[model samples]
Target: MARVLYLGGLGRSGTTLVERLLGELPSVCALGEVVHLWQRDILDDERCGCGARFSACTFWKRVGEQAFNGWGNVDVLRVHALRDLVERTRHIPRLAAGHMPMDEVREYAGFYAKVYNAAAEVSGADVVVDSSKHSALAHVLRWASDVDLRVVHVVRDARGVAYSWTKTVTRPETDGAEEMTRYSPGRSALLWNAHNAAFGLLGRRGVAVRRVRYEEFLTDPRAALIRLADFAGLTLVPDDLNFLRPDHADLGVGHSAAGNPMRFTVGRLPLRRDDAWVAKLPPRQRRMVSAMCGPMLRAYGYPVFTEEA
Candidate 1:
């Protein structure tokens, strides 16, 4: 069983940061959302973390060679279509139960399992950190026969997430062809509620999950990583803790297929909470998010501002 630490949550919730931090560990390999490998990195030939195109990068080329004997055998368009049909958020529960009648999902999961196994073999990693940020996909992988999956359910204050998703940002890898992503406050709130609830259900469904709040993590990252290390059954030595300097991480090239443009970030990283939403977001929008996510927010120890102006 290849150990997989799956980061499950809504987008813009700091999963990428957590994945990158864990990637610093010696025994863990961070594969940035292998789900998007076909479309984003492979077909589009985007920039890798190593600053080379996916196929051109030695690390990913090795991964391709190990996984498929070569990347040529992969049918990008067909696989993309199958993934869209089978990996929808609504399909998560059934997928988690291993009751998927869709042969496409099984086939895809089989392919994904092979990639993860190959990654571990080639990288010599005891664990693989997947910052896919999709509860549905994480659930499906839990039932994979070849992968041992542990989940990190990352939650953030709905207001903060709603604000982040509302802004437009560009990715360096996309050649400005596509913006990062955008969502209405109402939509982000509803999805945030649903995704977090689904991950909680996944834990009850026998998926090993460790819940981490983005706010709490930023407050004390060292403590968070300590808890995460214990949950994932990995060790974190003193050298692996490099939060002191913003340019301290000796990041190496990774064959990550897809994620935020932050994947391109190397050297030192600063840890801080983005609280811009508190002052910048309109009051009505905040109320809407608060109302939609109020109960869950309170349940998770996040404050609700529904009564505010």
Candidate 2:
């Protein structure tokens, strides 16, 4: 099995940007929203943020097709539990090996592993990036005893997330806190804490994982990705350096009208450490996040709020 990396955080926490930057590697077959909403009409495929259809690309097309064994792509993870043909046999062998099996590497790490690995091989990359952003999937990947897994937990300031949330949600990249039934002003804050916390739990369970700030990744993708590759034990090459290629707009299976989630520039300034959330958030939301995620902020090295922004 190939080295598998998962990018997870509270939604909209820059997973897309991380995917794009990692996709720069010639050896990486970058997958965004592999956990995409495949069941409910594919919520507008519009070229992914990568600029390709969820089911059209030669790589994703196969994964899209194979994931459901011809029933069609189903993005929702729970749906796999409901469907008989969702791909247990497809990955059981790979996942049971207790260590990654190079010859029989299966989807992303098992189930959809082949499609992703095939695509990466096609791209001449030896490593693959699955920016599914679904904690559920991360939970499942945890069961793959065969594959060595690395979880790249991307965290952003609650204020940064809140500010981005205030703006029109560009994509369902993350189901914003307000969108969830369990949402609360403190929800995003706890979420920011929860994502990293889960990684910690996994670590205690003896899982090998690495956590990085979304800001650190963008500030220097080269160092970040290289460090990431090293953590995964994947070999680095020149192709891996092209994470910001303009044509990286290639995307996964979604819908035509959804437009492209992968269309933005390869580089952007890191989220402001001090006043980013301040500049974008309203007083109430700022207060909520500060009050809610305050301890986590301090733990991760952010200054504690004296008074909410």
TM-scores of the candidates are 0.93, 0.69
Once fitted onto the true fold, the runs of candidate 1 whose alpha carbons sit more than 4 angstroms away are 243-254, 306-309
1-309: candidate 2 lDDT, tens digit per residue: 556677777765777666665665545656555554354225444344434554444544544554455324444454444222322323323333334443322233355454444445445556667776555456557665554567887777766775655454344423222232224446666666666666566556566668888777666656777888777677777654643333232322221212124423434423223346665577777777777888888887776674543
Candidate 1 lDDT tens digits, 79-131: 77767777778987777666676577767677788788888988999998888
Error of 1 at 22 (Å): 0.5
Specify the highest-lDDT model's number: 1
> Candidate 2: worst 10 consecutive residues by lDDT?
251-260
Model 2 TM-score is 0.69
How many pairs collide in each candidate, listed in order? 2, 37
Error of 1 at 108 (Å): 1.6
